[model samples]
Target: MSNCSGESNMSDVLKLAQKFNCFYLSGFRTSECKPFIVQGFQVGLIRPDVIKQLLSFPEVFHFNQDCVELNPAFRDYDTRSVKVDEVLKELKTKNVFMTLKGWRDECYEVKTQFDTPSLLKMDRSATCLFGIRNYGVTINGFVRHPEQGQCLWFQKRSASKQTWPGKWDSMVSGGLSVGHGIFETVYKEAMEEASVPDNLLKNLKSAGCVSFYFESERGLFPNTEFVFDLELPIDFIPVCSDAEVECFEILPITECLRKILSQDYKTTNAPVVLDFLVRHGVVTPENEPDYIKIIELLHVPLQTIYWHRNKIKENGFGANEIQGSQ
Candidate 1:
């Protein structure tokens, strides 16, 4: 009585299992079922009777085809019968919910209730009139010696770049893609901007980060940045991507701090760079007097900067507190 074609092969079933992380529940029903596919695997809703039959299968854990086991903790729930929004809310909080192959429609239905923006429209527009929500990864390359103290590596933004053309900034930084995790973004930006390999990434130490709201003429950008510190050999050559970086410089930590404090850095986003260093205790008040003045000019509250640092430590990453104007 199953609607599924008897012709459905083991390869197809395996693909489904890999995509949804679930075993085949039923293979007979096809006509009345609404099919969904994720990761190239097809899944379909089952009738109550078909659900019972699916449950009867020795390998099947749950009857819901749209719910898949991401981990041992996930239990199958009938997404067809369940309210999508409620399920998505639960999924967001839990972070462990895995969808069956072809369950994107259910996910979309849930996303709609949370006031999610149109990804289609946003993708089309190059100029973000409203601030585009973005989470970025930052890496701070440090060189140190037993006798000589620490130095920091910085990259000069490419002249062709739109925002901060030909200005010195963080060694590496970039926005995370939708659904990309912090570490993934960090690795990606490092590879793209600095040509750092994956093998070297594991050796980098995370020095923490600064969260800030930046409003500019172009649009508002909410940056949740993750900072990493890496101590490399003195002879290490940094390969800069011409598309993203124009050049690289290694400067003494004190000198770097001084430049940032003095506001002599030509980078358009220098304020953000300086704020990050000062907020993270990398540039202490005693070490840099001009930093205080720069902070004063921006009228940025000391408490807010401190809060940004603490929030990153507590949460591992910052979230956008300010919603973008639609």
Candidate 2:
């Protein structure tokens, strides 16, 4: 990529994870955000602007000093989904919210836990407005080269992508949308984004998942990415079969880390790949001063934030305690 100079301004690898989960770096005193309550559970952390806009639909949203909550009467899943969808559609017609302008026609299940049933589904792009807990899969495609050692595969996102256009990303990345399971998303993205064949897909190994709380100009991203490592034959090369990727490259670990730290790299996937490096021994506790801190940043306790509502309420959850739950 013309944008990459193979230079990184980041002095410590921990900085990458720190940047991703910046919500904690703020001293956990988030007075600007509001809790997005669903079915008596706090599902997302709503931003100030979004909260103001959501309050406009008084019939759909009600607020207490503690948080902004959905209508309690819309009890069932289907009813909540329909009511939220209707509001999202109206918001789409207006250009005030940039998130609605980038709608993918894809919906993300809004829930307290990934294994639990969804309370409702919302447009993927608009989920940020509510600081929704999003799930996705990230695969690190690699090969043990005879001469070059282990190298990682990277994809340049399609320039036309709504978010992070033309940025360097994981070999294969896909979201666990409304109906897709974790491994199912992995295979689906592997084929569509990198065209990895079935034989190589068998090598896909689940390393674990990385969770972080990120806030961007768009919204809060409490993302948990299930991580996988796939070892391909040294002779194999990736071919992009989908419009999502512009091209692919295979770079050794050192160079791959630099690419990750580059400005063109996706911030959300940084912790994902770093977890892979930590597991593969590219980054180690003996060598890196902040190795343990990086690990903590990659595994934020997002899954239990909603599950332990009382922990938050007792904490006096400044800013609705969603931000403090970190």
Candidate 3:
């Protein structure tokens, strides 16, 4: 078999993560309870037995007939103020694989908006500490050549990267931590990854977001990425300023397509780059029959889960206002 461009299946790579409703790949299992409604959002799902374990942290979470939720009392508290160490420690002591060591230090918050009050806070490494959604960002850098046309810049990840080591990735990408805004993160990541100066960073255009519900060995990853398109000058070259990227390469748009189709790009980044190509008219229905499917795959129906939760809350159907309600 020839491992070449046309031989690879783009649909296989571009397909949205399989979803059981708003949740991903969760088959109908009686023991598995519906997802929890945290401040009117489907933050995560838990088994009935897991709900019992979470009850120990009464001030941190509330339980109802069908779901678990963040205790309303903590809405006004600092993201880190709601203490969850005891519950996490209990899960860890119980040998829950998701709560194991080396994943519990950097704090992460679950909030509807960046500046609004947080619904819950936990360690970044503990996403599966309890399955919840986290947001990130990916920035694409490209240059328009008079002769070669549009070309994209890709980074070869450092071998030491804890996740997806030694893979080709977008020009810049990073997790949107609790305290940072979208643009702030873009500037920081751009400077760190590709040495793009602030003056150049100012030209970045908001390219909306790409969302997916991914299941990994670590746990469920219901993620949304804010995408940015950066058009660099043709004469500009990217320099690696961080250890995350081993090196950088600028390739013609056609070669970029070949590399991505050949599975040379990281899994998450492939979709992001594909989105960029489609939006910029590089991939069109005339040339690629699957272009429409590729565009749809970049967005999943994650909002429906939260919308259902909101509607339920509007009908006066929710967890009891009292702390630790049965």
Candidate 4:
């Protein structure tokens, strides 16, 4: 309900953008987390508490003093996924932590980079436990209005949603779950979330991505949002097909920027919106002094941070290389 303490003193959009990226800013202490190594690659970062919890399952998680790795004996992807799922199900049943309670049946592919093969698949809710770098798609739906200049669409999330209930967000946004490519996710989320049809979606234009690291009570989130700009016809009105969205409203660019920086908007959604703003010339270096810094925050180096953490072994793997994933 209230903005960050003394946040009112922050006058520029760059300061507001920094609030969502504390994971790479003032928040993270590399000393407190262990690199979540899997298949000889540094894939995620696990906190000490989570490492301690995983240590209980020695058969599933092999370890050294520096990092915790998925047991090399699993041999292949299916075995690794099933084995890890077994442990997660046990943890969920045991109520190991609060993140397990909101478990969505959805699975997010865990990989060293977006192009790499999955090392394993984990329940979307539990990926944060390993500080996985998750990816999602965000569509910036906007229109060129005669009277209002340029207006962007915003959606009020359903009150029943698991996270960020009843908050204002981008028109069509959904996670990049396993088996879905970036372009495929755009088509799917556009129709499912906003009921925007194929003919309209044909105009979808890729505006690149926004990546950041954010942590909450749920856990660490190193997320990248593949952003797209969909220009809607003036007569087009978006209807929510999937019940994920409560309602949709069109706001002028100024109002959209205000809501994005306000307390009511979903913080995670702000980076993509800010990216849209900066890309469209709404926020500029002449107007916002920290333009370059915001650009850096929007693209955190999540993919490489893991391997570099605490000076991993120069021999290519962490301390020890697991023999399975090729």
* lDDT tens digits by residue: candidate 3, 1-326: 76654435654434432321124435222436556666566666565555666777777777777667766555544543445655676677776554355554666776654345677677776664355667788898999899899889999999987667899999999887778778888889888988998888889999888876665555556677899999999988888786888998989987776776654567666767877877887778888756665666578655443444445555665422322221
Task: Give the per-residue lDDT digits (tens) of candidate 2, residues 120-181.
Answer: 99999999888899999999999899889999999999999999999999989988898888
lDDT of every predicted structure (CA atoms): 0.45, 0.84, 0.68, 0.85
Q: Which is superior by TM-score, 2 or 4?
A: 2
Superior by TM-score: candidate 1 or candidate 2: 2
lDDT of 2 at 176: 88
* For every candidate, C-alpha RMSD to the true structure in Å: 21.7, 5.6, 7.2, 5.3
Least well predicted 10-residue stretch by lDDT in candidate 2: 3-12
lDDT of 4 by residue, 1-326 (tens): 87754545655676766778877776565567878888888888887778878888999999898789899888898999999999999989989778999889999999988888898899999999998999999999999999998999999999999889999999999998988888998898888888898999989999899889888888889999999999999888888887788999999886777889788899999999988888888988888766787788888776666656534465556522432223
Which scores better on TM-score, 3 or 4?
A: 4
Count clashes in each candidate, considering only residues at least 3 apart in sequence or on different chains. 11, 1, 0, 0
- Model 2: colliding residue pairs: 317-321
Question: lDDT rank, highest first?
Answer: 4, 2, 3, 1
TM-score of each: 0.48, 0.91, 0.76, 0.91
Model 2 residue-pair collision total = 1
- On the 0 to 100 scale, the lDDT of residue 202 in model 3 is 80
